[model samples]
Target chain A: MSQKVTRRQFLNYSLMGVGSFMAAGAILPMGRFALDPLFQGEAQGSMITTSVKAEEITEEPVKVDFSYEQQDAWYKSEVTDFVWVYRDGDQIIALSPICKHLGCTVTWAGDDANPNKFFCPCHNGLYEKNGKNIPGTPPRGPLDQYEVGESDGFITIGEMFENELV
Target chain B: MLYNQKDLKVLKDEIEFIDTVIIPFAAMDMDMKAPVHAGNLELLQIVCVQLEKQFKGRLLITPPMMTVGEDTSLLGMYTTQLREYGFKNIIVLTHLQAEPGDMNKIRLNEIPLENMSDDMKMEMINDEVKTVMKSVISIWNQ
Candidate 1:
């Protein structure tokens, strides 16, 4: 049997198609804009590019400060972070400057007597070259470590892992 | 450094290195008004945090001494206690216009929020706290 196509039916089908296309065109951009942040992953644990370069890292730990945008719901602000970056033979290490005993910022060599160790000026807490808490020191645990990734000769510091030494 | 268990332990073990103790003295005239007292307490806390951030290694921040309906007469007692704990340089940061006799006292007020936007006021507060803390550091050096 031959199928009959009426002019009214053909017009209805064409109008429906055109209406759906227009609706999609209007809705797609708005949908993407509303959901852009969700696709960017959760704001808390994202890697941020640092000012540190792989070539600049030496045996002596260098204090590198970087800022990244932190989003708390609708509020967004740049949060500054600092790390002690150094090279141990073939490996690159990035340690957080926060002291384990207290939240005081630790320095590469803040103490005159303990010039080779990472020193916390607040309480004289010391960490070894490998970020290990010196035995008999105030800090019971080692400094937190930043997961590092390298691309295009620049280092990207990621989420912190507490008590991660060496 | 703050007056927490971990920090106190650190202080006890390395008392020789420590020379300063910042005692945040927040005295409230509770009879005045609830909002006023709260505002005073809030500003004191902000100044404390700024000072701790600025001179973490050089000083220990004792838990705030908040005396409701009290005055600066208690300053002498606090100084004596802090001196016994081996703090040579004691700083009392208060909202009350306290006189510096035995210990250094700094007076600060909250940035008035009546005439500015919340964001602008917050920025001003931060700058104000930082400036006050820098002056406190200079006083400590002297």
Candidate 2:
């Protein structure tokens, strides 16, 4: 004799399978969001404050210098000696004059031959005002941007970790 | 007048005179906002004449050769042409003043003029000439 399946029993099995699929769909995105920061692998770094007045600075860029603090590891103390900042209107972006390639200072407006390009004397590394490296230049990546805050007309900035520099 | 009187003895004299040529070569890698040797090209010219006078006929001094070109210049046709035609009795010498210890393996050819005053620099070159001359004379006479 042939056996026949009950309709009530088939409906219950189908409902349970759909319910489990819905549960998994809700949980996976939430789990990834919570752990994304650690997986992204970018770290915040050190920077200093500058009292450069926004009104005083014009559209013409000028080199601003300052000092900052850095911690290599626990129990290790470092005071970063130098940094360079550029200001245009409400926008203030500071670049570590230090080259990403080998820790050389990239100079600003040195040669009239190549205008508006930051040049590194050690090797022919060039970058535009936005810190994007010129194509075919020795610098493999753009300069790092800092997190900036203007408090009482003084500019404070923080660097992202070296790995984030790219 | 330079020859001393000692009866001009036997078939040959014990002492021999030889002409020695001294070349001071500097490897310059830095930019030439300066001269032949560390912002002092004119100093090299003055040193040349002083060397010629001190060594007299015993030495012939070569003009400064700018090592501005890369090491590949050593193989280039121009370098070979210059070597074949311009320089005579040429031998490569290399040394530094910063050698360790009181006594060590010293190749006199590449020796550096120590942190000496201009006067001392000249004297060092003179002494170098004397040492090299003695060797050159011995080899030639033999």
Candidate 3:
């Protein structure tokens, strides 16, 4: 015959484990839920236009400059700036020339001799002419893309957010 | 504050002593495909890092404040922040690019030189100088 287990013994043995699990379930969501606002308030959209005539955008990528309003949510402000625009077909897109690694404005620094890639003078962040992150460079991700819209013969660009900037 | 080594050298080589540091609250280049100019968290990091290097010893680089960060309803907060800073540091505003709603990094620095006084204008030319020294200040503050 097997010895019978008492209800009191079971409660004493498992009480802590059950309570800890309950607490975790209650806390995890609340923690994540609270920080959602931070994510939502990252940054908002802006507009940019390209001087590249609609017919001028060739098959290759070209960097253009455009300006528009910036909607800051944290302090509730509206500012503007010019962005570098890249054109691919009728779709004219813009990317911030800033090196992704440390936020240095990677101007048209020209090409490197050995690799022929654009370099950031700040920390030597590298990017292909197309703005792709060079391997082993400080910038870990690809350049941010802009939304494009054409009106008449002119091209317009918008900000990129997450995957889609607009 | 934004600068490379040359900027710092120029300051030390030329204006060895600097009292007032004017950090222009405007993204230098916003319209680009690269992340650095995209005006995101990375932008803030880069700016802060640069500010630290330039103002490493004594400076006050404002927080990465975005004009578009808040809604129009809270413009007062931004104005207050400016006022809090004594409004002595003027804002070098820029013209907005078209289709701003679709893009995030179209912002660019188009400093209004005309609006600024002679002294204020000089501050911008040596902005890199300011950037380097302020870098030191930023590091200490953090």
Candidate 4:
């Protein structure tokens, strides 16, 4: 015995097939759009790589230069900034050069009197090796710290945070 | 700090701490030396940015002031206005030879930055910034 499909059944089957295809076409993009941020977050991780090698960081603090793209209003430019990196025992530490007093760049041993300390030339602010704000200085708090890690024997800098050592 | 709305709001109350103002002067003559003028303006801007970063607590950088040639007659009046606005020191940063009365003027070196590599440009700009910074510091010490 041979069986033949009815016209109504044929229409229902075709309609369901096309309807599901169209629905998927529309929903797939929306799903991707909803999860776009996750994809981007994985692709553009917060860590920025620097040129300095991990082994180059000694016990004495040295300036490590890093460049990153900066967006200001409608303009985009590559800005180069530096951080103070040093080796403390087996761990590496990075500190922001911005003074806590008033946003001035601090230097390592900038002031002659303050050897072995980060000194702010603008107002004579001083910070200890551990980023602690010394007494009688203009800095109100310790220097901010940056998340640091080693990748492929090179130093990679990440998000800045409050000084944990202090 | 910069001459922007947010900074100006804070500047009104903190004029005592931020007593110094840096005016970036540039020449915009549309002649054969237009490119040279443009290069000087770029170098001036870079130096000003570095200077601001070094002395943000005590310095306020103004917008670049453009003029045709070395006619700095308008600067005298501008300086008076700035002095009247409670700024104790008004330093003019430029590559031109201009005498804006008795106010301090820092004449930057005219380097052909366009003909150099990125690293060389940065090194040259940094040296210029250091010299300008030294002058500013000496003025402060005085």
**Candidate that scores best on TM-score:** 4
Question: DockQ numbers for every candidate?
Answer: 0.24, 0.01, 0.04, 0.62
Per-residue lDDT over B34-137 for candidate 4, one digit per residue giving the tens place of the 0 to 100 score: 99999999999989888888899889999999999789888888888889989988999998887778789999999999899999998999899999999999
Question: For residues B51-115, could you state the per-residue lDDT of candidate 3 as single tens digits?
Answer: 44423322234444444432233333554554454432222212233322211122333444556
Report the alpha-carbon TM-score of model 1 versus the true structure: 0.55
The per-prediction tally of clashing pairs is 2, 2, 69, 0
In candidate 4 chain A, where is summed lDDT lowest over 10 consecutive residues?
A118-127
Ordered from best to worst DockQ, the candidate numbers read: 4, 1, 3, 2
Q: Candidate 1, residues B1-142: lDDT per residue as tens digits?
A: 7888977888887666667888787766657565666777777787787667656766788888877655666778878888998988888777766575887777776555556898987787788777776666577557
Highest lDDT scorer: 4
State the lDDT at B91 in candidate 1.
80
lDDT of 3 by residue, A1-166 (tens): 9987799888877998899999999999999999987876654324345575667766444556565444656555433334455455445556666556544456444444525455654445676656677788667766666566665777676656432332
List iRMS (one decimal) for every candidate.
3.3, 22.3, 8.9, 1.0
Overall lDDT per candidate, in order of appearance: 0.78, 0.50, 0.48, 0.92
User: What is candidate 4's CAPRI-style docking category based on DockQ?
Assistant: medium
lDDT of 1 at B111: 50
Ranking by lDDT: 4, 1, 2, 3
Q: Tell me the spans in candidate 2 whose CA falls farther than 4 Å from its real position.
A: A1-47, A72-78, A161-166, B1-142
TM-score of each: 0.55, 0.36, 0.37, 0.84
Off by over 4 Å in 1: A1-81, A84-95, A99-103, A106-145, A150-156, A159-166, B32-34, B68-70, B113-118
* Model 4 per-residue lDDT tens digits across residues A32-94: 999999999998888899999999999999999999999999999998889999999999999
For residue A13, give model 1's deviation from the true position in Å.
40
